[model samples]
Target: MTVISIPGSKSVTARALFLAAAANGSSTLLRPLSSDDSEGFAAGLTGLGYEVVREPDRWYLTGRPCGPAAGEADIYCRDGATTARFLPALAAAGHGSYRFDASAQMRRRPLAPLTEALRTLGVDLRHEDAEGHHPLRIEAAGIKGGELTLDAGESSQYLTALLMLGPLTREGLRITVTDLVSAPYIEITLAMMRSFGVEVTRGGPGNTVFTVPPGGYRATTYAIEPDASTASYFFAAAALTGSEVTVPGLGQGALQGDLRFVDVLRRMGAEVHTTADATTVRSTGGLTGITVNMRDISDTMPTLAGIAPFASGPVRIEDVGNTRVKECDRLEACARNLRRMGITVATGPDWIEITPGTPRPTEVETHGDHRIVMSFAVTALRTPGITYDDPGCVRKTFPGFHEAFAGFAEILDRRGPATRP
Candidate 1:
């Protein structure tokens, strides 16, 4: 079995950056992700006048609990929603005037819900470009938190942004979410908050009330775990090509909710073994397809779709319409990219069904989404000469994805200058 270790969780990295930026003292984070998304987040913190140091796999952030530096500045979030969403709220909490903008894809993603909620909290923010899109001009003169209703049906990152910054408000914050999706991400938020000594009370399912104490975040050293979403690609690779793959640093009891992907692998007829710190997966028999609802774990949709073509029956993925607002329209990208490989796939607004067919080798376009890049790379194990446009996009989440793939698979022409899709 080929063993591989993925980087720390992007979810964890973004949250830890926010915690460190807002903490009372300097905080050092180990094994943080160094992808484009994370880089943009770190840049945003630095642009706001916080001192940040980046190493090979660690980050040192000196907190500015009082707020970012004086003066209005433009903080470009690129296409990083975690940076775009969380940084604005953090800046607003500390009373600063800043303008936030992103790439075209991020501009299309909605930010109104979070902005409106912040407005309800007495922070002044005006949309510079589109009514509900990016290029947001935030005039932060401090905020008084109150109860607010948020429509999180489009993206859970909106609610998570609010939840993360809610404690910094004067009154604390109570969020009543309507049609909240990607619920597992919320669990990650709560868990990370508790790690930093912040407490939040869960009213019930889909209802949460947050109470940020008078004192702000306390500085603490945190070790980030391996990303389960990134691990899914290798597990899918093993299942698709009859190879034995062991992903170290990920246990069955992993904190990431996406760790349930191993169960999905088993459901597709793969043998999975779990240890205290790793999960090994291998194809047991001929793979049989099954239908699955991936609401809580939508991040795995692309990997599941990429592996579906190797199954004996049709693989159906359901309850992931919210993926449309992610870095890319994941459902549509999965279906379109699989079709590029001459696979028979069907897609709806919220579901996808793929039937195995004569797989043909073709270059896949990632739409600059890391999951799309990794998902299609798994298909290369079974196909011949499959190249990915902008393969470097995987650095957005997994900086070592190409090197990791080269360990077990034959990677052709990866050293040349990266090609944009």
Candidate 2:
């Protein structure tokens, strides 16, 4: 049995950094994620003239809630979607000029909906390179939040960005979402906001109307919880290899909606136990596949698909049509990767079905997506041998993913300069 204590959640870290930068005092973030994606967001803050101090494991960010210090800078978000989406709105509300751009992969990701909504709020934003895409320049202007409609069918991140910034807008914002997906992630945003002394009102099932008070963000200390999405890899490893693994910092009371994955694990014959602060999962017997509707929790689809071939029956994942717009088309990637392993996998626009097949070694390409890398790493534990290209992609979320998986599998480094012979 191996116990892995993963780092803080990337989702939480990005959101906290934004909130801390928007607050009016010095905020210290403990156990912050130090990776390319996270560092890119922190760098964006620094570019906007905010003081961001990095320690060994914690980050100290001095907030200038009024606006950025210099009031104008060029911000490059790299490949981080959280930074790309959230920073634009934060910069718009400030009294400065800013320009944002990202890598090729990020360029492919859409930002039109958020931009259009920001434009509706009177932000002076212009597309430098591609219209409805990244490489945007924004002049510091105040926002008047009123009735705004956004198309969230493509990515829930667009909606979350509006939701997070709604509280900071002048009149507070009334957001009307059309075809919103990833509802659980929105719930996470609301919960985190409330924890930091912000109130959000959900009008009804699909309609959310938020009212941000006239005052600014309330400064306070916040500790981010462990990432359930990152924990999925360890749980998958245990299920595939019949190993007992305990993941600390995740329990029955976790605010993260992805924690529901434990229910799926229990159904698949893994012994699941939860305490006040930790969740332990052990595979007691062979895995029995089950069907799951993953609309609210699409992030776990890759992890679940990676181990589906080891189950006794077919594992069906449904209602994940919006996953097409993630860092990559996850459905196609999962199917393609599983086929490489000799698994009988079928995929549709909104569903994927996987049946157990003969185990074989295969090479999986991560496509620079962190989930893809972590999910296939779980498969490496049970298969004869599996190699990954661009294993460094795990830095997007869990920078120490390879080290954590090392407790249960043999990790061979084959990358440049870091190759182990």
Candidate 3:
């Protein structure tokens, strides 16, 4: 078995930065991801006058329960949705005039759901350019949180931002979510908030209402887990190449919902086993196609789509319409790239179906999306000459992805087909 060490979870690192920044004292994060998204989140905190010290494997953040120390500041959120969404909520709970902007790509993504909810809570937020988009300003006089309704259908980061803001408010917050997607990501936020010493209550019909009490947060030493989304590429590679890949630090007790991508692989004839501290995937000498609903784990949809052409039947991924609004239209990007490689593919508003066939060598148009680059790398295992138009776009999450995957591919080439015990 080839054991691969992946980077820390970008989602976890972003949330921990927010929690640590709001806690009562300094917090230490062990093994935090040092990627563009995570670095952008930390940089935003620093711009807001929160102290952050970075080292090789750990990060130190000094909490400011009262909000940012800077009376005024401008924060550039880069391309990180977490930084763009959560930092403004953090700033809104403070007394200051803050301006927030992002890259053109991020500026094009939707910010209405979160911004509208903040506005409903009496936040003085204004869009300097396009409505429901970035380049916005916030005149913060502190938030007095109360009951409100939110629709998180397009993105769950909207709800996550508010949930993380609950303790920083005056009277706490009661959010009744009308519709939600990526529900497991909300669970990650709640788990991390509890680790920072705040317990949020979830009780309503189908747990639709979230009640978070005031009192801010208490800092604690936290350890970030490996990114399950990043690991999906290697797992998919194993499924495609008849190799065994073992990723430590992710197992049955892992918090990320993306880890369930292995369940999808299992259904497609890969052998998947999870232990307390690790998970392993080994192909069973073949691939079988199946239809799956990937709404909760939509991040791995591209990884599945990348390997779909090698399956024995049609591979259909459904219920992931939100993917259209990500860094790019991921559903269409996957279909386009697969078709570029001489594979048959069909797409609708929320689904894509791929017919099994041998893929021809072709350059993948990455659309500057990291998932697209990494997912297609799995396809490159069988179909060589698979270059990416913008391979460096992976810096947003995993800067060392190319080197890591190249090494894993070398190991698979030497080991040949994996044997079952």
Predicted candidate 2, C-alpha RMSD? 4.6
| Model 1 spans > 4 angstroms off | 204-214, 410-421
Per-candidate TM-score against the hidden true structure:
0.93, 0.94, 0.98
Candidate 3 residue-wise lDDT, 169-196, digit = tens: 9999999999999999999999999999
The deviation in Å at residue 199 for candidate 1 is: 0.9
Query: Judged by TM-score, which candidate is best?
Result: 3
- Which model is ahead, 1 or 2, in terms of lDDT? 1
- Per-residue CA lDDT of candidate 1, range 130-151, in tens? 8878898988887677788888
Q: What is the lDDT of candidate 2?
A: 0.81
Q: Show pairs that collide, candidate 2.
A: 71-96, 96-140
List the candidates ranked by lDDT, beginning with the highest. Answer: 3, 1, 2
Relative to the true structure, candidate 1 reaches a TM of 0.93
Full-model lDDT for every candidate: 0.82, 0.81, 0.94
Query: Least accurate stretch of 10 residues (summed lDDT) in model 3?
Result: 412-421
